[model samples]
Target: MKRWWATVPEIAEDVRDALAAGDDIHAIRMLMDGINALPAAQKAGTLDDALNAPDTTGDPRWDALLAGALRYRLHQIGEHAPSWTFKEPLEKGWWPFAYSPSDAYNDMAHTPAELMRLGIFLDEREFTQA
Candidate 1:
């Protein structure tokens, strides 16, 4: 199956850059809303299974940052946005309903290790544009 959160590093970098450049919630809102509207979901998995997945990637910082981004975005919206919801391709556990990627992202426990392996942390300074 294809990995959904795989693209998060690049997208997160963009979000981080926007946040650092004095972009308020409204600006962040626009960014999030716009991205969420895309045909492809940048991140994947249902809220249930994704939330329960192990962090085999061995990098806590990576997991923390990914989780923080999702949670922060949720806070901005006050609730689940319809565009953020989706279904997990492979059924793992006892989940009957599909989950929102937003929910999966918000859940700290489920941030995949693959997200960390992508080298998103290598250049934190690059996110801060002049």
Candidate 2:
């Protein structure tokens, strides 16, 4: 499979380097900056497209990037419009239930970045899980 990081722009190389160096803060900042630099309309549309797109690549890294981007956009939106809800999976192939951001993040995240990614399909977004 193609490496998702390789498909991203040059700025991603810098983020990847930060990640490899265990500087998650810097990496996240760069990621947020990259997302923020886009025009407001484009940023909203792009993020919506990314989040709603199907995950057919079957690549963990790709999923992580998608999820992380979605989370960051959602966070930006939430800053101005706080009324939002998310559906949380209850069981395998079972109906998902509504969850507040706080509860979902608490239950799903083990790191700040993970929380920033909203833990969407997290099991499929990590190398260790693969």
Candidate 3:
């Protein structure tokens, strides 16, 4: 029989709490695991949830980057960005997880155009961008 499930907002909430506590790594873990657990979720729906998730950690950079990265993914799949995406400003710094300068460069070389514009360099794309 097929499994039953809905959107995974729990993952977003978990990420929000983790980020609020300054535990971004844990937040990314939650994001990756959630996507892995529900890999077949409608891509558009998942991206929509991401765009609206992450309510605010009082950190504009993070808030906006998350929205932009998710929105970038939506654009990649040919979906329209939710109107609220413009509310997120383009952050100026690389996201908090950058391990080194070279890593950031490598990431930037491959980051999609929209995310680059939003300034989400050096992301954990394998999962967080999923």
Best by lDDT: 3
TM-score: the better of candidates 1 and 3 = 3
Order candidates by TM-score, high to low: 3, 2, 1
Residue-level lDDT of model 3, residues 1-130, one tens digit each, is 2433223346556767888798987876765555454434453344444334445645576556555655565565566766766644453656556588877777877766655676776544654454
- For all candidates in order, the CA lDDT equals 0.34, 0.40, 0.57
lDDT of 2 by residue, 49-117 (tens): 323333222334433553454444456456321122232322232101115666444434433343333
RMSD (Cα, Å) of candidate 3?
4.2
Compared to the true structure, candidate 3 yields what TM-score? 0.65
Worst 10 residues of 2 by lDDT: 89-98
Encode model 1's per-residue lDDT on 35-100: one tens digit a residue: 342223323333323323223223233234344334444334343423332222222221111156
C-alpha TM-score for every candidate = 0.25, 0.35, 0.65
Of 1 and 2, which scores higher on TM-score? 2
Off by over 4 Å in 1: 1-54, 80-130
Ten-residue region with minimum lDDT total, candidate 3:
1-10
Q: How does candidate 1 fare on TM-score? A: 0.25
Best by TM-score: 3
